[model samples]
Target: MSSTLLAKPQMRGLLGKRLRFHIFGAFAVSLGVVALYKFGVAEPRKRAYADYYKNFDATKEYEAMKQAGVFHCVRPRE
Candidate 1:
């Protein structure tokens, strides 16, 4: 009816007023989400990985794989 409300100057002016707040709101939301992910998932996963490697015996695993004949050297294509 009224040429799509978006074409109205009043609407544009309203959007301009709230545009900065919207941008700031989006930024705040994204930053909060990232912080939550880092604390809830990434940090815990990193800590778990560090703990796993800390007590891990790489030599034992390599020897076990060697004994099982599971280790193989791939030849390069010449």
Candidate 2:
């Protein structure tokens, strides 16, 4: 019996092409994840904080806390 279809230059070229494609695809995916986190996740949180603080009224709560003075205490570090 004889074996045929040994590794050839064309095969090597095809493998190289595929490797390049995979590397570039991985890089694109990483960049997309970072962009999503920066814009999609962080922006909404920032907007929510801004909106809450814009309409927040802390005066009544502060006055109540002052009258009660039952403040939460933090233990000193040893």
Most TM-score-accurate candidate:
1
How high is each candidate's TM-score? 0.70, 0.54
Off by over 4 Å in 1: 1-12, 73-78
TM-score, predicted candidate 1 vs. hidden true structure: 0.70
Tens digits of per-residue lDDT for model 2 on 1-78?
237666556754798899899999999999999999989999999999999999888977665775676556633235
lDDT of the structure predicted as candidate 2: 0.81
> Predicted candidate 2: what Cα RMSD to the true structure?
7.6
Residue 64 error for model 1, in Å? Answer: 0.8
Q: Residue-wise lDDT of candidate 1 within 1-78, one digit each (tens)?
A: 677666535644787779889999999999999999999999999999999999999989877777777857733235
**Poorly placed runs, candidate 2 (over 4 Å):** 1-19, 66-78
lDDT of each: 0.84, 0.81
* Candidate 1, residue 7: lDDT: 55
